[model samples]
Target: MSKTILYARVSTADQTLDHQKAQAEASGFVIDEVVADHGVSGVSTTLRERLEGKRLYDKLRHGDTLVVRWVDRLGRNYQDVTDTIRHFMRQGVVIKTVVNGMTFDGATQDPMREAVRDALIAFMAATAQAQAEATKEAQRAGIKAAKHAGGKYRGKKPSFSRNTFQVVKEQLDIGQGASAIAKLTGISRQAVLRIRKDPSLADEALKRWGE
Candidate 1:
């Protein structure tokens, strides 16, 4: 019998992984194991890079079933998300999402079914990518507007700690994009971009805030 695995992700400390698992259970999935990535954003981090996510890659075998709350939990960008799905499909693993209960199985040999499945995957992946872009754009615009209002923009307190900031700096030094850093560190992309733009400013703020 194929094992059923549940993968859950929460981008911030506020989100709870247990809730995601509960949601999956409520959706009637008989999850055999749970793999969770806490304080990890789905917008840019590769599946293989996440702690539990990487384990999932190694633990999953052919004919396994992977369940997620939604496609966005798998990935944010279209290419990355689709590639991950395709990889599992090729491994003879079945992918299913709890939200809409969509399933992708490689066992199907019908060309028309395959085409339809591919189309759905493309549409979902594109939608996820667009949403992430829109969110980042909105954050940028909000910050810009706040800046335009003069000294009223004191800025939100940094969500990350000193160690996290150091990690962000290391990722930046390695030429990682703001989005990728944000996803990996669980910080907002806007914050990652700000840190990338001015590491000194971020450092000063962290010190001032005593983070």
Candidate 2:
């Protein structure tokens, strides 16, 4: 029998921990112990930097199974995730994913299986790292654009609350991505699309405060 330890993480404060826990439980993983890094940014992959992340390395022992919701919970990038998993396996710890039912251990000697698993891990880790980088890039771009564009965005008067439709139009004009604009403006992306679609609102802008 294998002792499973559930690990869960969420990127932001807005996200709830229950969702990740429920997903792991639903996948038939017995919640022996859960280590979570709540409201911690995923950009930092170091275990010591994360809240409960350090506990994972300290509490987990050899012959113990580490169950993660996905490979991303292990680390942020390809090298980090792969290296960490490999190191744990070397330490006699087995790594498992609740979502995929995949396991990585020292006993597996099949070259093809190892290759495939490595490929999958690489792909997912790359995605996680890329996402973090993309978020950083978007924030930088938004700040730069806001300062450059006239009334596009200002610290004094926020872009959305100042002129919702005009801000949307300006963001559209600046070629900012919908999601990036939505996140910066705190307005629904759908609203940005609607404002873009309907030019009539361009002339009659709303007061920018309502439900």
Candidate 3:
């Protein structure tokens, strides 16, 4: 029997494995299994690179359903996302998303349907990549501004390390909640909020403390 597996890349504590499972269930997916990659950066790692993500390749079979929060969860960039989806579709796996309840079925023989499905996949994949790039650019700009200011802005050093800030920024880029990021990084929610509010300032603080 084919099973419906819910896959999630949970980088934060708030969105735990259980939370993801519940989210899928609330979205009407009768998930038989849950596959999650914890503390994984969706913007930096390809689906195949993730420990749990790789398992999907081996665990999934023809006719099984693979459910994700969105298409972005399947890859790190436009090309990667599109390629991964196409690969899975070719293998006869039906891909579904909790958001928008989108479905991509490879079982169809209709040319029109296939074309539409492929187009949609391309659009969503590109959009995901675009969003990631925009977020990255914003953070880069912030860092640049902070560095140029050169000790002009002085305050208490941020509670997060450079690594933690990068992780938080990545998760933010992928649209993860601040509270969730705070919980995962073991920092205050306000700190996460502050980072979100002004990433450049956060970077400057990190630089001041040599974190």
Give the alpha carbon lDDT tens digit for every residue of 56-165 in model 2. 77877788999887787766766777777777877888888876687877766899987887777677778878877887888788878977885353222222443666
Give RMSD to native, each candidate: 8.3, 11.9, 8.5
Which ten residues in a row are the worst by lDDT in model 2?
202-211
User: Could you estimate the TM-score for every candidate?
Assistant: 0.72, 0.63, 0.70
Shift of residue 58 alpha carbon in model 3, Å: 1.0
- 2 against 3, candidate with superior TM-score: 3
Off by over 4 Å in 2: 152-211
Residue 181, model 1: lDDT of 85
| Model 3 misplaced regions, further than 4 Å | 12-15, 152-211
- The digit string of per-residue lDDT tens for model 1 on 1-211 reads 7899999877743445666788889999998999887656777698888888889778889989999988988878788899999989999899999888899978889999999999999999999888889988988888889779873444556778899899999998999987778779887665676677788988877776767
Model 1 poorest 10 in a row by lDDT: 150-159
What TM value does model 1 have? Answer: 0.72
Which candidate wins on TM-score? 1
Clashes of each: 0, 0, 0
- Model 3: per-residue Cα lDDT at residue 62: 92
Relative to the true structure, candidate 3 reaches a TM of 0.70
